[model samples]
Target: MTLSRRQLLQAASGLALTIGIMGLPALAQAAETVDIDELMKPSPLGDKVLGSEDAPVTIVEYASMTCGHCAHFDEVTFPELKSRYIETGKVRYIFREYPLNQPAYAMSMLARCMPADKYFDGVEIMFEQLRSGALSGTFLPALTKLSKQIGFTQESFEECLTNQKLLDALEAEKTRATNEFGVKATPTFFINGEKHSGALSIEEMGKIIDEKM
Candidate 1:
């Protein structure tokens, strides 16, 4: 079913309570009031991309690093799709953050704190760390190893995690997500702005991607 961005947003408002309880610092840019059309616009915070921006299909995914379901999708489904569809220019795939834990949120922040070219690279390494089930271990320590590969020193990683501006932007995105997109779970997807709430198999996602192609 198709949903106007406003309608989809209204469906998601209730999920914001948990985020609120974390008491994140208030940001001047928070989407305190939703502007349905504006909120639907793609975020500028991620590595801005242009891949057949007018491509007939657009896929948006909301994921958290600590989530096993998200890790599964990254490991099994995304690579094939990246090779077949993304690299081939048939669709525009947007990876958006929706972290469920403080550590996940910190990882997401570090990923975005770098130059655009390194953003996804950091994310990939961090995901690999999670795949190893290291998040249950000390997050900062595991993240330190991932950081070194990308030239992120302990100081840089800590700074990125504590950056109020970065946190604010992420919170804004999360707020926009919950109050506007009905995203209640990790690995949630939006195919052309229509919502899919949970993880699906690589085969299942491939079938959908094939249909879109």
Candidate 2:
């Protein structure tokens, strides 16, 4: 379902508690395996790649900002992956938006609004805020705090969330992921064209990356 700006803000107002208590494993279990070919289809919305183009392995992630499991991976697992793979240029990591709810859609749009170099920074901040229970209260106040830290003023914050074009683009991308790539849940990973779901441990992710190399 497409979420308008007001609806998304309303969703964000109550999202913190829902995401805080959500079961990550249950979210993982909701996803079904898809063919590697289908999982590896070119992203319709382009990509936000981190690492060298020539990296031997490519990792694509479809994640929702409001998903508890996605937050766990971002907070716990991603640093190691970034250091060992993304930083060393062993893997090219691409993160795609797959908002599961209206709040998630709003957060994704905000991330896109940041300068290209700050996009991932915006995402990490959102995840951190989610983990810290910052979005539990009024959505605008929490978001405004983050926006100020990232150079976004009140005007820009409102404008970004209300950008209909960006919202539609994110919706289209999410639709392609669900309909074409069989992505049923957040934190779904496609490593070297193989689909996996869940908050995979560093060792588990490393093994797969090593095998690809």
Candidate 3:
């Protein structure tokens, strides 16, 4: 992956995490805006919410649909976490788009096309397509199929994709990541305000979640 300036900064932050240290808490306490400019960007889709609004544990994953590691995590890891934590009201798993390529962008757009209630399910379906290598030029076609399964029409799909407001919202998400969140890669995770880069194993994630619990 081509590293951007923001990514380099995140690498430094990750190192701090490795050492069991972070400045975010102190910065928040001081009422200083976190160096992460990404948080300020307004999302057109609002926040991709899962679990309850008041859930104690919030797991936010910034993932690209074209990322194989992300697909793996979605397919293998996320389900278990959802079952054990999110389903039981112990956690809320929120997925935010982090498109790294054109395909990923399309996939993100497709996921957003679903009704708010089905948004995350749409995300899972999109990632499944990506994992199957069917998310290529077949994005719209695949979305059409999934949409049909969920009782959406082709017209609705087209309308959703062509929605300028949604496009602007997604663009805003990308800009926010670059400017505020210091996001530089796909499959980055922020668990309870602590950020993690790269796709970590479920066990590794569980260790952190266990501690938080």
Please name the candidate that would achieve the greatest lDDT relative to the true structure: 2
Candidate ranking (lDDT, best to worst): 2, 1, 3
State which candidate has the highest TM-score: 2
lDDT (Cα, tens digit) per residue for candidate 2, span 49-144 = 899989999889989888888899998889999998999989999899988877777778888888998889889999988898877666656777
Clash tally, candidates in order: 1, 0, 6
lDDT of 1 by residue, 1-213 (tens): 222323322332222212112212112221222343543487647534435676666777888766777776778878877777777787778888886756666677778888887677777787776677554444455566676777877788667666766766776787778768866568776766656655566666666667766
Candidate 2: lDDT over CA atoms? Answer: 0.80
Residue 141 in model 2: shift from native, Å? 2.8
Q: Summing lDDT over every window of 10 consecutive residues in candidate 1, give the lowest-scoring window.
A: 17-26
- Candidate 3, residues 26-109, lDDT tens digits: the string is 111111223323442336577786687676777777777667778778788888888888888888777888776544555576
- Per-model TM values vs. the true structure: 0.76, 0.87, 0.73
Candidate 1, which segments miss by more than 4 Å at Cα? 1-40, 44-50
The Cα RMSD in angstroms, rounded to one decimal, for candidate 3 relative to the true structure is: 10.5
Off by over 4 Å in 3: 1-42, 137-152
Quote model 3's TM-score: 0.73
- How are the candidates ranked when ordered by TM-score, highest leading? 2, 1, 3
**Candidates' RMSD to native:** 11.0, 2.9, 10.5
- Using lDDT as the measure, name the better of candidate 1 and candidate 2: 2
**194 Cα displacement, candidate 2 (Å):** 0.7
